[model samples]
Each structure stands twice: as C-alpha cells, then as structure tokens.
Target: MNEPFAGAAEKPIPEIWYGIPHGYVQVDLDPPVEQIEELVQQVLALPDGLRAQAEPVVQFYAGFVTALNKQNARACLLGMHLDEYDEPATSVITFSTVPAHGTSAKAIIAGTAADTVDGSAHPLELPAGLAYFSEEERRTPAPGRPAEGSDGPLMGDIWQGTVAVTGSGGSEIVVIQLVTSAVEMAEDFRNILLGVAHTLSFSDPSLSGDEAGTGAREPEPDSVVAAVRSVFG
Candidate 1:
C-alpha cells in the first residue's frame, strides 16, 4: 500500500522519476552523521523481536549503499516489510544512468532480458515507454572465499527487478533497479515493481512547466501513487 508522496525538497530536474510504496523509505545518500546515528538509535530502542529483524536489514543496506555511493548512484530507497513478507525481508531500490551508445530502445530491452542468465525478463503487460524491464535471481559468492570451516551459502541468492528507459534525447538510459533477498516473493515484487515502472517518465525540458504552457506532462503526485498500487493492492 502507498500514500501520496507528501513531497520532498526541491532538487534538480531528474532524468527519470517513479513511485514506490509506503513500506519503503528513501535513503538519504548525503545525510549528516547525526541522521544516521539517530536511525541506529531508533532501531536499538525497538523491542527485541523487532530490533532483531530491523538490524540486519539496516546493515545489509549500509553495505549496499556504500557500494552504490562509490558508483555515484542517483537515488536509493530501502524497504522493510516484516508483516507483508514471510520473514523480515528487505528491498533496495536504486536509480542510475548508463550510456545508450547508438542502440535502439527496443533492442536494449530485448538484450537486457535475454541476458538474464539465472532468471528471466520481458516486456511488461503495460509498456512503460520503450523501457527495459528485467528480473534476475542469482547467487554471487562474497568477495573472498569462505573460511575452511565455513558452511552453507557463503554469500546468498539475490533477486531483483529492473526498469530502464531512455532519456536525455536517447543519449543515455536511466535505470530503476530493485533488489531483495526474499527469493520466494519474487513474483509479488515483480508485479509491484512493474506497477512502479508503469508510472515512470523522463523530465522533458521542452515541455511546459508553466500552467499556461501546452503539453505540460508533469506528473501529479496522487496519480503516481494510484498507478503503483493498481497492480499490488
């Protein structure tokens, strides 16, 4: 379930924009140390059961966000859905851009889906404007081999859904990637992710940002929220 995006501080016009559900919180990529420590303190104050569940989710994203920061990710969101999921599952959503080279959008989508080695990808039932949609589930070993005495999965399976759309006059592709470890919820997440992707659009400077301008395509906050929930709820 989701609510109208209450609103966030004004920022530069984004190349791509999409909506996520209520269970998710956007990770402030450039927050002061105090903000992060405050979050940690809140988690610590939770009851043992809730704290135990939240701690790992926080840590997992801490590491993941660190990696994304180094890659200069555009945006990041974290989802913790203990009630809706079988376990205390976590989801990481990120936005990033990649060069389109000279490839056509359709070809990019097909190639991306075809490259799903461990899982599968395809076009959405409702197309999201020459978008690339994909789902993958795979296990990648941790950076280093496990100790000799170690057992079980050294790393773990990774499940993710991605949506990519061309922007900046086709010079680049903006990607929306959502990753979670709850493999069992893959289908549900795929549905929810598609719902979000369906609402995505690239900001067009040429279009009217003014109320009097014709062909103004700015999204209404409420409509985006409604679209994302149409599939999941």
Candidate 2:
C-alpha cells in the first residue's frame, strides 16, 4: 500500500545533508458544540445525577474546541494545514464528535514536509496514530538508522522522533520521520521538529498542566495489523 502520506519515498541518501523524520502528538480541547449544547439542555431538563456526568463532558468539550481553533491557526502559520482528505476547513469547527464518552475529546493533525536545497515539500500523513500520540507522549525517540551526510556516527539511515499530549478531557500527538539525500539536512529536520513541538507547547494554552507531559505509546504490531484490516476491509 502507499505510505500514509502521498509523497513518501525510500530513495538513496544524498551527499549534501541528511533528512530528519520527526512526529509529535499535541493535546488540545475539542468538543462538538451544538451536540454538547443540546445535550446540556436535555440534562438540565432531567434529574441532577444524570446531569453530573454530562457536565464534565460539556466542560471538556468547550475547552477542546477553544484549543483546537487556536492550534489550527498556529499550525497554518507554521506551514501545516488540516488534513483536507479527512476534514474540510469549515467542518473543522463543527460538532462531529466521536462515539466515545468522557469529560474529554480529541482532534489530531499531522503531516510530513521536506526541505531540500531548493524548496520545502507539503505536509503528508496526518494519521489517527499521530493524533493519538500528540495527546499522550512528551518526546519519544525510537531506534532507527541515521541518514547519509553525517561525518561521525550514523550516516545512512532515517531517524525518528515523536511528541504527544494528554489529560483533562482529551489529547493530541505528532510524529516525524526525517530522511534525506544529505545527512546534515536530516539532522536539521530532527531539531526542527523538536523546536516545533516546544513552540506548540508554549503557544497553545490547552497543552498546559500534566496533560502536556503525556507521551504516546506505540501500539502492538498485531493490533496494528488488525486496525489496518478493519480500515481496509
């Protein structure tokens, strides 16, 4: 199958600089407003106990939406865009809540971009996995080969990095896999991804508190296979 993103490739290493593969998950508040409002009204009309569980959900949703909007704008400024294949720009603010329950909700966004000697590539592969990671993990680095262009250790394989967020009522994560014709460029990409995560944490208010420290755990290989089957079945 094609890689999660469209422009991914496994080309040979470059002579100039290496590319960095980085990913992260960020936690931001997202709630289905209309649905929550409607639910709130219904709960208020009901007995007190029924409304209690629903109240946290409403609060969580409100916080989520506020965070999502702010983060979306921030991503755009950082050269990231919402995954149009899955969600429209307008609908980004709508109430398409997932079928799960809790005082929390989530919104995932991710993509890959390349920086060449010439120009940068568009972001790709904003998968649900990346989204979930943004909410849970802080910064998780997996073992992978280094890219080409390095003068010391690690000279011809890709390096992977990830960051995530969780807590309150929701979570978000982003992962990046950096590789390039030039090992230098790859290393640069890794640093850039790290900087981006830090910047996101600083700018986005919802990523505050213990939630921002949450790290995403990798799913088991078997579970991954099952998920893929469910999606493509």
Candidate 3:
C-alpha cells in the first residue's frame, strides 16, 4: 500500500496569480457569503409578482460573479443594480487586485453600462458599512491630537478607501478603519484605494480641461493618503 501511494498524491493548487500571493481575497465585492445566501433566501420567499420584478435584479447580482470571472479572474464585488425605468440594461463593475506585491492587498471598482440612457453609467456609491470613518476621522490630526504610536488609533485599524468610476467620471472617499482580521484585509484595502484613485483620475471636475486643453489638474496626494488612512487608521 505504501508503495502504491508513494508519489501519487494530488498536487495542491498553487495560490499565485498575476505574481501575487494566492491566499488573499480577490474580488470586487466582499460581503459575507452567509449574508448573500440570506438575501437570496429572502428574495426566494417573495410572492410571484414580487419575485418576477426581483428576478432581473437578482440576476444582475449573480451576474457580478460571472462578470468578475470574465473580466478579471482575481477580481470580484458585492454590487446591485436598480432599474429606474422598465427597460433592460446591463452594468459592469471591474475590480483589480493591487499594490503589486508583499501581501498588502487592495482592489478598485469601475462601472460601465452595456446599453442605457444618458447618466445611467456612474460609479456606485460605497455602502455605509464600508465607509465606517466619519468626516472627523478624515480631518488632519491637530497639533495636540494623540499621535498614533506603536499601537495606532483605534479607529485607524479599520481604515478603507473608495473610488467610484462611471464612464470616466466619479468621486472617491476614504474610510479610516474597519475591524476585520482576515488575511484578505490588505487586499480589501488595496481595492478601495485603487477604486478611489481611478475615480479621481477619471472623474473629478477639478481635473477636467476645456476644449483649449490647458487646465488639466491632478489630485492632491495628501487627499488620497488621507482617504486611505481614514479607513485603515
């Protein structure tokens, strides 16, 4: 038996992708699977009329997984779509795992419409839960404010950043801290940071230039850093 089994074990799947560690969470949306299941169950429980209306919405959510797989194997998201009118539409959100290397995980979000009316394509808003940091947290630490020593501010621990991009337009905000200890935390942070960066680069009105093409502006690094720190503080 030992002879028969020797050197015959199945090789473990290597967790490497695009040169990044294979163990990190890699998706646009990172909602708890249980929460998603619960939401599905609730939708299933609705009456036919409600279910009929909700079917397309649910399909859109499910399609996110497919979209991620199709666009970026390592990207994913927790997103939803609402029909402002009774027309069919499809939206795509892209997530990219970032920070290049060293297990400091992150990702970004960008949205595009397959077919729709004007203004249909826009970056989706970050959910409240993800934006845990208050505006106060984003404020620069005052001269006398308690400095983060070895053990940083309690709020800083849950920091996150966000960038929403819609058809070359969007906004970004940073969350200071969130209390998640999974190995994937870094990846999550990266996603939010990239999302914010992409949105700012593509959308912020300050960066827009007139037909003369003379007034292109760049986002302030301090603002970007503050946004990231606010969430990860």
> How well is each residue in 40-88 modelled by candidate 1, as lDDT tens digits?
9999999999999999878876887788877757777778876353568
- Residue 206 of model 2 has an lDDT of 26
Q: Is candidate 1 or candidate 2 better by lDDT?
A: 1
- What are the models' TM-scores? 0.66, 0.24, 0.28
Whole-structure CA lDDT of model 1: 0.66
Query: lDDT tens digits, residues 108-184, model 2?
Result: 32222232223233332222222321111123322344567655444233333343322113432222322222222
For candidate 2, give the lDDT of residue 56.
Answer: 75
Ten-residue stretch with the least lDDT total in model 3:
1-10
- What is the full ranking by TM-score, best candidate first? 1, 3, 2
- TM-score of candidate 1 relative to the true fold: 0.66
lDDT of 3 at 13: 16
Candidate 3 lDDT, 144-184, residue by residue in tens: 33555735433322223333222111122221111222222
Query: lDDT per prediction?
Result: 0.66, 0.31, 0.33
lDDT of 2: 0.31
Q: Of the pair 1 and 3, which is ahead by TM-score?
A: 1
Angstrom error of the Cα, residue 17, model 1: value is 2.1
